[model samples]
Target: MTNVLSFEWKKEDYVTISGMIDESSDFSELFKKNHEVLFLDLKNIHRINSSGVRKWVLALDKLKDVEIHYINCSFSVVDQLSMVPEFLNKKCFVESFDARYVCENCNTSQTVTLVVGFDIQAGEKNYTDGPERLCPNCKQKMEFDHNPDSYLFFLSNLSNKKKTAI
Candidate 1:
């Protein structure tokens, strides 16, 4: 039962959020203010849920002009969001890479198939961890999958790997 906490902005044009953005968040009010860029500063945010994601999507649609960006998101948040295609597709922002491959050109999501509970490893090993290779669909080199606790670090932000363009 953690309570949601955040700051209210009126004219900063950049909204930074901390704390949990759960059901208690004031999404409606935040959307009404009309910010040009919404920086959901999840730097200190510990977690999020279905309700929170719904609110974010709804607010995103409302704030069509607002360029949304997420910061300091935890691996759990990244994995959860990747699991939800609707939410993943809506976010046109680049992630810090804790287990998602965002196409540089199309911005499409390419998540690794979770090999837990089904494909048990012969020993203590994470199945998600595989050699890095180019995605067959996009032909762009995708980052290797990581353990849930490990954070995926990106070497570069500028990636639009298309064979035609190369």
Candidate 2:
């Protein structure tokens, strides 16, 4: 588990969370008592455990009325979104997240940023079928690291929220 200092509050309206989200994370203080919208920045988060998932669910339960917008969600966060059905809640929305890719030749992995309503086009959830990226380390074609159907399952819920017409 990473240190509790991974959570940071800013402007009394937004919270930026980094590092691994484990039992050590203090999500209680991160949620404000009075706020219409809370922008959560998960850009730097890399991991979340079962305990962290439980804590995350409980924390969101407390903010039922608050509109939470998730921004810069890493691959770990994406996994949570897929596994934990209530993790995102109805009031929450994902703005952008990271998609993983790897080079078979070099075994190099990279994360590509994908916006909820942009990079993930409607009726085209499989990134593997999309454009191929050049591996930064090996200069070879990089493949999607995880199964598209499983990795992008969370997007199904968001597809109707801010979807861009194709």
Candidate 2 lDDT at 116 equals 63
Candidate 1: TM-score?
0.50
Pairs of colliding residues, candidate 1: none
Residues 1-116 of candidate 1 have per-residue lDDT tens digits of 24565754533554446566667767665666656556554445557777877766676677667655554455555555546544433333432323455455545666543221
Candidate 2 per-residue C-alpha lDDT over 71-164 given as tens digits, one digit per residue, 9 for 90 to 100: 8888789899988898888888888888778898999988888766556653354544424678998799999777877777777666456522
Which sections of candidate 1 miss by over 4 Å? 8-11, 88-91, 95-145, 148-166
Q: Which regions of candidate 2 deviate over 4 angstroms?
A: 10-12, 103-109, 122-141, 162-166
lDDT of 1 at 5: 58
**Best model number under lDDT:** 2
lDDT of 1: 0.48
What C-alpha lDDT, on a 0 to 100 scale, does residue 76 get in candidate 1?
A: 52
